[model samples]
Target: MYINSSETAIIALLEKIKSLEEPDSAGIFYNAFIVILDAFVQPFSITILVSLVVLLVLLFFSAMVSGSEIGFFSLGPQHLEKLKQSTSGRGKLILKLLERPKRLLATILIANNFVNVAIVILSTFIASQWFNLSSFPVLAFIVQVVVITALILLLGEILPKMYASVYPVRFSKSMAGVLNVLIKMFYPLSSILVRSTSFLDNRVARKSHVLSRSELSD
Candidate 1:
């Protein structure tokens, strides 16, 4: 009786191993896992790339505005040096530029509009001949424009600006070197642009004042 029972247990163990070794079942499970992995990974990869691109574009604009405004303010060397030492100093510089929030916002809006329009025109021309759909392509293009614009404004502009505002000092300090290099490189052109703008504004104001004076006299 004991030998019979031992043989029965061995037979059950062998059957379990055989079932696990079956090629069809194992292959099906393996393929299912692969499909699941691909489904999960592909969208995530695209999302990450898109986010990174948007963030970089926003940062570039933020840096440009920060550099130009910091140039305009003309802080003393001592304060500037101290700012360079602080944490998030680069972000801080950006926030400081936002002191005139309206102007900074206007600059960003104008820059975004210019870039998006150029991109749309180029994309439309390139895609026009590829697709034969009458109105679908145009509708798709409009949708793409809206989605990209919203993504840029939200992920690129609002989020980064908010984060920089929260930790300006640290951000500015961290990016100080990079910002300094960029500012220096673009200084000549930025100077020319800023000065020209100021000159034009002053002229307009003067003309407005002169017209008001003449009207008052009459």
Candidate 2:
């Protein structure tokens, strides 16, 4: 009746270990993997449910941000001309963002990283709750590194970008509203990154030009 937080946690871990010990519809390795994946399959409480939901939403946003990079950048000169002539507010916003391409790219990179980090954090929390992942270092590493990396690569990066590339304007227009908000929110950081990269690029260009001139002299 007087179970403290530690005791509760211990009890939960014990239950998870007990579940792992039970026979399932699969073999040892598969069952172990399933045990680690229990967070997705079993939602025993509202907190886990909410975490799962938020994790999914973050993943979706990650996909959107990743896709937006391809969507906006792949726009051709003709597409940009169309954007300039278009009366739609979203098209106007897209043109505005493209005016400062470095800043816009920085904003998308920052937002994508933020969303992906959140997804990893929320996923870790959910996994920890469902299983004593710490007890299995290798399994934990697999789940955390390999599995999550694959998910982010496939779901957050590749698939969305593929779609975006095929329908660049539509994807960019769809993401215009979200991108506008993110550009403002991340303006400070994005600007700093833009300035730093610009400075580095100029330095590199100068160095390359000097090397070329020296080669000509020789």
Candidate 3:
């Protein structure tokens, strides 16, 4: 009876091992684990998270810079004097920077363009990293444009400008140093843009200044 009972226990252990090694049983267990992991784990990695945060920060600053243009230029003579008298270093700095309109315009334009380019590149990287965007070629391009454009248009351009218009003096004062540094950084490019715009303006003025032939209309 003891020998018979020992044999029965050994047979049960062998049967358990065979069941575990069966193809259908192993496949079911493997697939179930995969499903559980998929359900619980988020796909984003640290680098992806960092990139998104940086992208948002860049967009916010870009919008502010774009709005500063309107805010700085729109100040009337009376408001300008008030800013000049104010003790805030930023207010004084704003007046000084505004003295050279061409330089200011060029700097703002260059900086804004740089920020926008960065936004586009970063956005593309995110889309590729997160969504494997290249797989859907047309959709990738469209998604990139629509997402970036909406952010830039709504946050970077329209809202900032509207806010600046409402508080031009305050906005200019706050952004004075930032604009100054950006201007200095891109001075060469800013000067070139100023020269080109001046040339274009003079050319148009000369054409418009020319008189029609007396024989025809004069």
Candidate 4:
């Protein structure tokens, strides 16, 4: 009787252990699959990923403009100081930015806007195709339009601009450091492109002058 009771107790304990381990095996497998899926589906995980990439590109361009402005301002800081001393000191920074940085910023804005527009158009087109709707009904169209516009405006433009505007100095400084590293990494290719662009601009300017002279003579 003692031997039989001990054998029964052991069997019960073994069965309980097997039951607990069975659930854990499936749980582990499920967790492993989830991790793999998350890794593979990164791009689809969030709607903002694409917008973030665009924003980063815009920020990079902005950093380049800031760098160029810094270069111009530092070129003759003493001269600028003398001018500032002669005039109202308050307008000096504004004037310096207006002379160069503003133009660079405007170019960046134009590029950013163009990219945003392209993204909106492409997204709408793809959505339309995916839904297989011949023409969007009025209500559905309105909703689609609003949703798409809101996404682009909020995610791509307003949010980033607001953040940058509120913390311009900090953001610019950080971006400047990043851009410096990137420029160093790509210096060889960047130098070639810069030189080629400069050469082309000079050639275009000469041609334009010659054409203007010919037009005046005629």
Q: How much is the lDDT of residue 184 in candidate 4? A: 53
Candidate 1: regions farther than 4 A off: 1-135, 208-218
Better of 1 and 2 by lDDT: 2
Candidates sorted by TM-score, best first: 2, 3, 1, 4
Whole-model lDDT per candidate: 0.51, 0.84, 0.81, 0.50
| Tens digit of per-residue lDDT, candidate 4, span 8-36 | 44455455555664567666566546543
TM-scores for all predictions: 0.42, 0.79, 0.76, 0.36
What tens-digit string does per-residue lDDT give for candidate 2 at 112-185? Answer: 99988888888888877765555557888888778888999999999999999999999999999998899899
Worst 10 residues of 4 by lDDT: 36-45
* Candidate 2 RMSD to the correct structure: 6.4
Error of 2 at 38 (Å): 11
Residue 21 CA error for candidate 3 (Å)?
29
Evaluated at residue 60, the lDDT of candidate 4 is 44
> How do all the candidates rank in terms of lDDT, highest first?
2, 3, 1, 4
Candidate 3: misplaced stretches above 4 Å? Answer: 1-42, 212-217
Error of 4 at 169 (Å): 2.0
lDDT of 3 by residue, 1-218 (tens): 45443344345545545566555766656655554334333388998999999999999999889999999999999898898778988888988998898899889989999999999999888877776443346777777889778888999999999999999998887789899898889988998999999999999877766643443565
Residue 106 miss distance in model 4 (angstroms):
1.9
Model 4: residue 58 alpha-carbon error in angstroms: 9.6
